[model samples]
Target: MCAPKGAAALYVRDGLRLEPVVHGGGQEHGVRAGTENVALAVALGAAGLAADDLADGAPARIAALRDELHQRLAAAPPGCVRLNRPERKRLPNTLNVSIDDALGHELRAAAHGIAASTGSACHRGNHTPFDLARSLGALRLSLGRWSTADDIETTADAAIKSATER
Candidate 1:
């Protein structure tokens, strides 16, 4: 199921970048061409409302978990780890960190059941040559409404273990 609001609200332009994917009798004010998924739209709307309601307390809890994870990882050997992005100007639930001598893909692959975006592509065999991936070991971790304290602890342990392993 899909909803138009996620991509639609991201734009500042008066119109979309291109035509809709499934062209038919123009629907969704001509922004989306296919028949609307009414159930999905309703679910999206309800989730949005619930998220807005939880926004105040949710961030504080998420921030606490994120900070704890950062602190645990920071306890690793000096010069072995660094934050890829500055903490002062980021979302409370997002952490981007780089572990020296540890490739992001390798660490993530070894981290069972954990999901994150890798900023390093050192393990790529026939990779697209990107500048950042060629030199960084960044992992982008994002905690959501469902993330638990146990999850954060496990992630931090896995990351620290991966970074320290030969």
Candidate 2:
């Protein structure tokens, strides 16, 4: 069920139904009743449309960036790092590399300049691994729309340097 916003259309075509968890008007859908947020719905629809338009081109761009990042990081000394997600099955923008020698807390503290996460933002400052990571025995590094080639290079360099120095 976890997919990018661009893939929602595909899911819809695959017969996945999204029932309203909360309805705006009473007796409209027989779901939870509440006032509808028309503005939010319009914004979401617009964003989805934009994503759909760019999805075809996005995958290739993301893949190239991801490959470059992996190539850079994989060159680091052995036992210093490990990739959490298998390359083939992972989201293209994600590169969840594990600093095997450093704790997540230490990594976070060291990565002061880079806007990266040890795991999930929801668990920020909690000194805990993401719930998913805790359950699955893996860490995470989620990339997003703002991620650039330079950002990747800087982040990877900083991370590797930090891990080595630690």
Candidate 3:
């Protein structure tokens, strides 16, 4: 899902006086608009609540596990790995590391036991680097509610071993 800030930033910086290029539905704060999706709105609200609940203890737990994995993997072998996201600023449950010689697709193909992604699922078949990585030169790894201490340990071990072998 797209973060809301980019569009909001454009509107704020450009002023709200632009004319519509195409018109079908009613106006929306001088931007193009259609009928609001009530169901989606409700779902978003529910998600916000769920996120709030997850924020209570999830961040600290995930951060601890992530730090452990990073430290251990970084200590494993010389020139084997590099963490993509800064440890402090990164999302707690996410870990993106680049292997010096390993292609993301190859790791993904061989990682049969771990639930991980080379990048966003949306751009999987595009044969291009992840947009964020293209802009900043980093891989992307996302973790979710089901991610666990075991998963992190297992995945980090597999990643380090794979990178070393390659």
CA lDDT of every candidate: 0.71, 0.61, 0.63
Expressed as tens digits, the lDDT of each residue in 1-166 for candidate 3 is 2223222223345544776666767656646667656666555545554466466776777777777777776777765667776657878877777665567766665655766666666765666544443323234556655667788778777766666665
Best by TM-score: 1
lDDT of 1 by residue, 1-166 (tens): 1234542232546654666677777676665666667766566665564466376687788888888888888887666667766778778888878777777878887776788777424555654434354335778788877789899889988877766774
For model 2, name the residue pairs that clash.
Answer: none
Q: What is the lDDT of residue 133 in candidate 1?
A: 48
By descending lDDT, how would the candidates be arranged?
A: 1, 3, 2
Task: List the candidate 2 regions with Cα displacement exceeding 4 Å.
Answer: 1-27, 49-56, 120-139
Better by TM-score, candidate 3 or 2: 2
Clashing pairs in 3: none
Candidate 1 Cα misplacement greater than 4 A, ranges: 1-32, 49-55, 120-135
For lDDT, the strongest prediction is 1
Tell how far residue 141 is off in model 1, in angstroms. Answer: 1.1
RMSD of model 1 against the true structure: 5.2
Model 3 compared with the native: what TM-score? 0.61
lDDT of 2 by residue, 89-111 (tens): 76777776765546665665676
Superposed by TM-score, candidate 1 places the C-alpha of residue 5 at a distance from the truth, in angstroms, of 8.9
